[model samples]
Structure formats: C-alpha cells, structure tokens
Target: MKKQFNRMRQLASQTVGRAEKTEVLSDDLLQIERRMELVRLVSHNTHKRLVSCLQGQVGTDSEKRHKKLPLLALCQTMQDGGAQLGDESLIGKMMEVCGQAETTLASELMEHELQIERDILEPLYQLAEVDIPNILKQRKQLSKLVLDYDSARTRWYQATKSSNQAMAAKVDSLKDEMEEALNKVEICKDQLSADMYNFSSKDSDYASYYLTLLESQADYHRKSLAALETAIPNIQLQQGQMGGPTTPPPPITPLNSPARELTSTPPPQRNGSVYLTAGTPHSQGGSRGPSPHLMRRGRSSLHVPLKGDPRGRPRIRWEDDISKLALGRLGIPQDEVSSLLELFPSRPDS
Candidate 1:
C-alpha cells in the first residue's frame, strides 16, 4: 500500500514538525528516551509482579476463578495432613514433626522461587519486553528520516530560485532528492546514538542483578531459619515424653493437723492397769521387760486396754500363733526375737 501511505505521510509530517517547534530529538537523545520509558514502566511492572509472586497465582480473569494453593503447596498439605493424623501420638508426634519442618520449608521455598524466576525475572523480561522496545523502534525510524531530510531541503531551495532554463532540469532533480535525504539522516543518526550509549552502559549491570536478587533472598531466609532450628529439638523431645499434670500439686495435709503419732507400743502402764507385756530380755528384778523404749519402737500391734471388759472397747487381738512361735518358745530375748516377730500381726482363725 505504497509503503503504508508513505509511512502515514511520514507520521503526519513528524506530527507537524513536533507542533511547529520544527521536529526535535537531541536533548541528549531526549533524555535517553525518557530514561528508557522509565525502564519500560518499571521493568514491565516488575515482570508482572514477579510472575504473580512465583505462581502463587493471581492469574487475573478476576483472579482466575480462585483456586490457588501455594503457601508452599499449603506447606506440603500440612505435611501430608500431619503424617496421616499422627499415628504414634505424643501430640501426634508433635504434629508429625511440625509438619515435617514445614515440609522441608516448602522444599526450600520451591528452590527459592525457581532461583528468582531464573536469575531475576528473566533479565527483567529481557529489558522490558525485548531490549527497550528495540531502542524505541530505532528512535521511530530516526523520526521519519528527519522528516525526509527536511522535505528534501525545501525542494532544493525552491528549485534553485527559478531563474529558469527549464528550471535547470528541475534543479538537477532537487539536487538528487536533497542528497538522498541527507544520506538517510546520517544512517539513522548513527544507529540511534549507538543504542543510547548501550543502554547507559548496562545500567551497572542491572544493578548487580538486583544485588543478586537480594542475596538469594537472604539465602532463602537462612534456610528457613535452619529448618526451624532442626525442628525445635524434636518438638522439645516430644513435649518431655508426653508428660502430664505438668507439675505444681502435692502440699495440702492440714485440717486441724494432730493425729499421726503412733509407732505402736503404749500398753504396759501397770498402775493404770494395762499389762500384756511379753518382750522380756530382763529389765532387772522389776521384771520390767518390753522397755528399751518399747524395744526401740519397732513392733506395732498393741491395742491393749482390756480389764473387766464390759465393752470398754480395747480388744484388738491378732497374735495368730505369732508365726508358729519358736524363737526358743518366745522367752523372746534373742535380741527381742526380732521385736517379737514384728509385734505378731496375723489372724486367720477367729
């Protein structure tokens, strides 16, 4: 189509010579094409919000009908539902080792979001969708070849001011169409000023690849805090072997506190009439036998308060053949026959 109507009439004569200021360009190549169109609109919205934050998905047809899991695949589906609801308990093995340390920290955060989408969003989407839009489309074809070399040097100075000898062969064909439109605007202004000085010298190597993507996101959060500090000592040793009532109890014993005194004997108070004394080694002629403080308070069974017994209530009698007697027939004193057979306490027959 006649070269798209002569490139839309050379973009409407360079938009009427840039609205009459007569078409411009070099304000340092228009401030490096407005700082490369603000670095291509901030690297095309930072490579579409970092590929929708590493595919945790905002696919966008109004959130693509909403089904997007990814908190590390919901932490590996809560570590396979806490290892199938924790079989060997201790709080289900501390929720199956804290969901297997958050599913190995979500597989090291999905290999650190696939190494930041392969080294920082594919080189910032190849410099915002292909090298600064191919250097702003070769600076709009060198602004329509500087408006076709100023409309062929104004028709070769109006055909050399018409002194007319048949206008000197139309002024030598308008001086070879104004020297072929000034050699195509000096070869597209020397290849768009060498691609805007090679994109300002690679902008410091793209800011050191964005500081190596923040040092690989601080080494993926220090390897997810060293895998939750190695699963917190196996969840505190399974909460101390699943212990219970967790502690604080045993002190009460009060309610008017008196009773607990009896270690046994209290019987042979002769003048008070309570006798049954048998542990006799020999307390001299007084015949007082069971006394070295009741033979060092060892024996126990001694409820002896029987006198005329009209049920005055003190007849406890469990001597049960005192283990078939024979410590030399109970003349006891073999160092009190093991405290009289430990105060004789058996009672089978009535």
Candidate 2:
C-alpha cells in the first residue's frame, strides 16, 4: 500500500512539473547583443588610445648617414624609432586580443547551448518518454473509474436497492485517490516555478560576470601600453650607441736602403747651412743632394701589420750603408750626424 501511494504521488508531481523555462535563453538575445557591443566598444577604445598615445610621431630615413646628423636630431630620431617599435609591437598584441575576443564569444555561445542540452532539454526528454505517458494513462484510468462509480451508485439506489454496499464504498475510495493526485500536482507545479526562476536568475548573473571578464582584459592591455611608452626611450639610447670606435689611417714607416730590408729612415730637411761642396762621398757633382734615406726611403714607411706580431711599431732601418763605414767611435764624420747636430743646435730631441 505504501509503494502504491508513493507511485501515485510521483506521477502527480511529474504531471504538474512543466518544462523548466530557460527564460534567460528565451529572452530575445539582448544580453548577447550587449556583450558583442562591449567587445566592439572595447576594441575601438583600445585602438583609439594606442593611436593617441603614439600619434604625430616622426621616423628616420635609414639610408641617410647618422654621423652627418646633429646630436639633438640623432637622439630625437632614435627616440622616435623606439616609440615606433613599441607602437607596432603593442598593436600586434591588440590584434591578438581581438582574435581572442572573437573566438571566446563563439565558445561561450557553444557552452550555453551545451548547458541547455544538459540541464533543461535532456530532463524534458525524460518527461516526454516516461512521466508524460504515465500521467496520461492515470488520467484515462480515473475517467473510466468515474463512469463506473456513477453507474454502480445509480443501480444500487434504484434498480438494486438490496445490492452489496461494497459497490458504493469503492466509488468513495476512488474519489479520495483523485483528490490526493490533484493536491500533489499543485505542489509539484509550485516547486517547478520556484526552481526555474532561480535557474534563470543565476544564468543572468553568469552573463554579467562575462562582461566583467572583458573589462578586465581591456584594462590589462591599457596598463601594458603605458609601461611601453615609458620604457622605449632608454632602448633608443642604447641602440643609438651600438656603433663602435672609428679608426684613422695608419702612419708612414720610413726605410733606408735600396734593398728590401727593414729600415728606420727620417725625412729630409733643408736649412741655412754652409757645407763643403768639395769631393766627398756624400756630395754629388759639387752640389750635394740629400741621400735617398733622407729624401724619402727605399720602401714605404707605413707599418704593415702581420698576423702574429703583437706590437705594431714601425720596423725602420736607418743605418743602411753606414755599417760599411770604417769610422771609429772617436773619429766620427763631421759631415754626417755630428755635422747635422751642429747645424740644428737647438733641437736635441730631434
């Protein structure tokens, strides 16, 4: 008897519990429209702010020589270049955000559909298959019982007044069963109303939170852009100084001989001097000209660098033919070094 009573209560509940109306889903997509609008608005605001932040800026012509440029203008050019780099880089980041926004909305919409499938549509399918048909069968059984009860009661009263009282007693029992079923249906309907309202309210709250998420993303990008604007100048300064030291031409290295031998030969000098124009090995046809070592040298004076040589000093050999001379230390030639020393008396270092 208890099992029968519980089944009866269950049937009454299922019959009265109408499909859960997802009024949040049913509302004419106003919330979706609002969210999409926010996306557009945020994108426009981001682009506008980025443009305004890096607007009216000049860039340099790379083909032009930076050395010919003034220091102030060079610094300015580097600064502008850094700002341009930051702007372009951040614009790319903004584009990434745009792509994410578009795809995220698409996924959110798919999720909402899945939510509907999981929460409302599947359970309603169960009602259609089992509960609804069961309720229909119970309603038909009650209708047939009503007719039978009426016929039985009428027959007992008129034609068979002496008939058994069980016939009338069964009709009263069926009436009580129908009354209980009606009360259960009323309670089930009330519960379904309360439950669906709460579900719709919660769904709307989730949608509101989705809007908050978009606002947060936009805020993050804006802060990053501000940081970039401040940091690019120092990067410009570093890049501007990336070029290393400038190198000058190498100095001339003097050679003393006709042969390709190392020598230290000094350049020729002319001055007011009265020297012997007589027959001397240094004189030529009564008029003396400076030696090849003095005029210039047998080879170039410029120090040619070899691979393994550490010191780049000039390898000049100034005492070329002087080694062949048989002069002693005490018997020096007056027409040579001692003579030149006497000629230029003031320059001892030279």
Candidate 3:
C-alpha cells in the first residue's frame, strides 16, 4: 500500500510540472509569433513608404508602372493581413467614378418614369373614358318626351267624353319626363365641371413632371460636365473662327412683262358721267377733251371728256406690281420697306 501511494504521488507531481512547462512554452511561442508579425508589418510599411517616395520622384510612365506593379503584387502577399492593412483609397476612387455615371443614369430613370405617367398613360386615360353615353341617354329621353306630350294631349281629348283619370296620369308622366330631362342636363353640367377639374389636374401634373425632368436633366448635365471639365484639357481659342462674307451682295432689279392693249374696242360707259379736264372746244360745236394719249387705255377707244366739261378730273393710274416684286426680291428690312413704300407712294388705282 505504501509503495503504491508513493508512485501515485510521484505521478501527480510529474503531471503538474509538465502542465506548468507546457503553459510557459505556449506563452513563449505566442510571443515569438507576435514579434514575427511586427517585423512583417514594419517591413511592409517601409516598402510602402519607399515606393510612395519613388513614385512621387518618378515622372516617366515606365517608372510609374514599375512602382504600380509591385504594389499590386504586394496586395496578393497581404493575404489574411489585407483586412488589417488595406485602406479605403481605391474604394473611394471607384465610388467617385460610379457617382459620375449614376448621375446621368438616375436622370434618365426619372425622365422615363415621368414620361410613362404624363405622356403615355395620362393622355390615353383621358381620351378613352367619357360621359358621352349619359348625354346620349338624355337625348333619347328628350325625343321620347315629345311623344309622351302628344300622347297625353290625345288622351286628354279622348277623356273629355269619359273620365279624366287616365289623361291626368299620362300628363303627370309627361311632366316627369320633362323633369328628368332637366335633371339630366344638370347632371351633364356637373359632369362637365368634374371633367374640367380632372383635365386641369392632369395638365398640371404633366407640366410638373416635365419641369422635374428638365431640372433633373440639368443637374445631371452639370455634374457630367464638371467631370468632363476635370478630365479634358481646355482648348485654346483660335483666331479667325468667325467666318462669313465681309460685304453685302448688290441689289437686283426685276424685269416687267409686256402689257396687252385693247385700242380697237370702245370704252363701255354706264351711269352716264364724263371725266373732264382743261382743254379747248371743238370747231363743230362739240366738246374737246384732254389728250387721250396721256390717259391710260387709249388703245381702246375710250370716253373722252368734253374739253373743259368743268368737273373735277379723275386721276388715272396703272399696275405697279413690278416695283413691289423688286422690293420683295431684295429682302428689304421693315424700315427700308417703309422707305421704299414712301418712295413708290402706291395709289388706289395702281
């Protein structure tokens, strides 16, 4: 028993000592791992700082690529440590590009939704439904009203020989029809008011949607343009960009067509009156008139005033379309046109 007891005690001591030693070894191992991690982190930070400095110093594309290549390679080596070391710089750059693209796309989405509601759907809804059928029904009632009135009159005439009971019933029915027609008219008027309200509401909504769409488009364009301004270099304004003819073209005159004369035909006169002018009397006691050659239509044997017939002379004129046509061809301005009109001074006869 004593020997067994000693062996048990010794076994307990040996196990306890090994447990303490294991705990110590584990702690030492953890410390060595921590030192390794620190060394790795410091070396990587030093490399990063050196590359950043070199990139700052370098200007050539090849040198930049050389610096970038190692950075990309180092990311792969970051392994599980990436979560601890990687920052949000690249992520923020990516977000910046996405924001630019989304500005235009979001604008388009808003425009599309507005178009669907305002242009495509609302207009169709307005045109498709109506209270026209109710108006038609009212018209039908009005047509039947006339018949009811006539029938009631006939019934009353027939009832004069008998009792007036049936006649009174039909008369009452006719009155009911009249009241119904009035009621229908009132209903239609109320419906028209409602329709107007709906129409105005729809119109206002449609216009508002267009305004929103335009505003959104403007915002999108502003953002996109800002990005483009940053991305693209400014172009220098070149000289002589404004180009056109330095001098105006000369004005063109229009040609006139030949006029047809009716010299052989005598001038027909009605409402017996003569146009007179200052002239001498004829030797045969007949009246002499102003020279026909100076008057228009001389080719046609026309009436001549007795020379000094003593009434105010009527002014003669001719076609003046040629002058107007020339002015039109010249493309004259309003002020110049007024000046030309004054120069030409168109009369009622011409």
Backbone clash count for every predicted candidate, in the order shown = 0, 9, 3
Screening candidate 2 with a backbone cut-off below 3 angstroms (N, C-alpha, C), the clashing residue pairs are 252-301, 253-301, 253-302, 254-301, 263-316, 263-317, 264-316, 264-317, 264-318
In order, the Cα lDDT scores of the candidates are 0.64, 0.39, 0.40
Q: TM-scores across all candidates?
A: 0.38, 0.24, 0.23
Highest-scoring model, TM-score: 1
The better-scoring model by TM-score among 1 and 3 is: 1
Q: Which of 2 and 3 is ahead in lDDT?
A: 3
TM-score of 3: 0.23
> Across residues 1-350, which tens digit of lDDT does each residue of candidate 3 receive?
64345334444544566311111123443443344344335434543443343322232343344334433333333432434333344333333444444444444434333444444334333333222233334434433433333333333444555556776566656556546644654555455445434443454553453366466557646765765565333211111122323346765533321222334444443211122243356889776655444233321223322234455244231123322433355433344433333322222331
Clashing residue pairs in candidate 1 (N, C-alpha, C atoms within 3 angstroms): none
lDDT of 1 by residue, 109-162 (tens): 666776777798888888988999999998888777666666666556667886
Q: What is the lDDT of residue 17 in candidate 2?
A: 66
Evaluated at residue 191, the lDDT of candidate 1 is: 86
